[model samples]
Target: MSTQTDSKRRGQAFAGAFAGVAIVVVLAVVFFVVRNSDDSDKTSAAAPPPVATQPSAAPAQPTDAAPQPSEAAPQPTAAQVNTPPALSKEPDVKGGTGRLTKLVKTTLVPGTGPAVQKGQTVTANYKLVKYATGEVMDSSWSRGEPFSTQIGVGAVIKGWDEGIVGLKVGSRTQLDVPEALAYPGQGDLRFVVDVLAAK
Candidate 1:
């Protein structure tokens, strides 16, 4: 009887100890879970808001940023400045007097006037135009006012060699020169020259 009683007491004590250990383990696990959940909430609340936004404003709008000028901004091209005037040449079919010498009275183009003595100066502006087409070939008018030439010393075309000696200053004349009198095979060309200054 005593042996049976002793065995029963020992078994009860072991069962009680096992139950207490399980309860303690459950409490510890619950405490850790609660602490971790509270910590996560506190960290999230304490974090600073994004710097991409400022106070008073919700966020920085992309369109609010300063605008940048594009390389594609409209720019003028060389073609624009060089665009030549569109002038058409109409055909004149009627019976005409043809190359009328009557219209070409005086000789010398505007800017190719007379001769300047050695150490002398003369200024002028000129444009070369075809006699038949009346089309201006080239001109130095756009470059500046005019250019100067000193004559009697032969610094110009042969026609001016004899023609410009006595031309008055500030006079404009048209020199209807034959090819032989001018550039050979260059043919009778017309020029209207201005004598801007003479010294």
Candidate 2:
């Protein structure tokens, strides 16, 4: 009976300690919940006054210069033979002299005569055309230079001899080469010649 009594007292003391620990845990939980509720209420009540967000001003518009109408450039064609601007009509004169009548039907632009001395170096540019057809047959202009040839040395065509006579230096002349002077056995021929230099 004494041993039974001692065990019952011990049991009672253990039950009381367990009850105190449970009470402490419940109080801590309640304190935490009450503090969180107060903090939430204060934040909700004091939401910062609605910030007046101003809309950004539109970016400055750019000013542009008006477009201009451009002029068209000159164009060349094959039939026109525009190697250079259609050579402006050269002075309209026969033998380029106020006098001489043009022997050939077509127009001619001549270089002033050069008194080609006998056996001198004569640099000349020439365009030869068949008088009947007005078609160019041969020309020194093809070489792009006044060709150098000996005058009165029997090396050049006969028409060059007759046409070159009595020509002053730096003179431009048109020659209506007669059949007798050029290709006598053949027909009439037209020659446009420029005497560049004579030595």
Q: Which number leads on lDDT?
A: 2
For each candidate, what is the lDDT? 0.44, 0.47
Model 2 spans with C-alpha error above 4 angstroms: 1-114
Per residue, candidate 2 scores C-alpha lDDT tens digits across 9-119 of 888888898899999999999999999999999998888766322101100111111011112211112232212222222222222222223243232433354466776
The CA lDDT at 44 in model 2 is 81
Best by TM-score: 2
lDDT of 2 at 120: 64
The C-alpha TM-scores of every prediction are 0.39, 0.42
lDDT of 1 by residue, 113-144 (tens): 34444435444444444455554443334343
Off by over 4 Å in 1: 1-119
Clashing residue pairs in candidate 2 are 111-172, 111-173, 112-171, 112-172, 112-173
